[model samples]
Target: MAALCGLTSMHKIWDKLFKRGEFTELDVDEEVAGFAELLRERNARRVLDLGCGAGRHILHLSKLGFGVH
Candidate 1:
């Protein structure tokens, strides 16, 4: 389908950008910090990052003591 092809093209573009070190900033956004707080409040110890391009959130969450994958 055209939609599927478009998605694949987008994926390739993102992969290239990631390889070039784009979107690799480690600074966690305020919203993510707030979400981390909520997770902590709930006693959540782990996070699954399904599309963790450049692993920014994974690293941030790990530093905050959550196991990130």
Candidate 2:
């Protein structure tokens, strides 16, 4: 029960931050471009972006010809 309450509080904080665009950068991370290049070299066609806040990486990966989830 305590853990659930903590999780709920954390979720609310994050939700507020997201609503304010705190971590919502439209530009992809610098590391992601290099990582995507490596994926391409390996013939990777899909990516799973865990904890994908705001979906910036999703958009970038999709633009680079990889399916993103």
**Best by the lDDT measure:** 1
What lDDT does the true structure give each of the candidates?
0.88, 0.86
Model 2 TM-score, 2 decimals: 0.78
The candidate maximizing TM-score is 2
User: How many collisions between residues are there in candidate 2?
Assistant: 0
Which portions of model 1 show Cα errors greater than 4 Å?
1-12
lDDT of 2 by residue, 16-65 (tens): 99899887777877798898999999999999989646678778889988
- Residue-pair clash count for candidate 1: 0
Superposition error at 25 for model 2 (Å): 0.7
Deviation in Å, model 1, residue 58 alpha carbon: 1.9
Candidate 1 colliding pairs: none
> lDDT by residue for model 1 over 1-69, one digit each (tens)?
999999999989998988997887778889889999999999999999987466777788899999876
Cα-based TM-score, every candidate:
0.66, 0.78
What is the Cα-based lDDT of residue 52 in candidate 2?
46
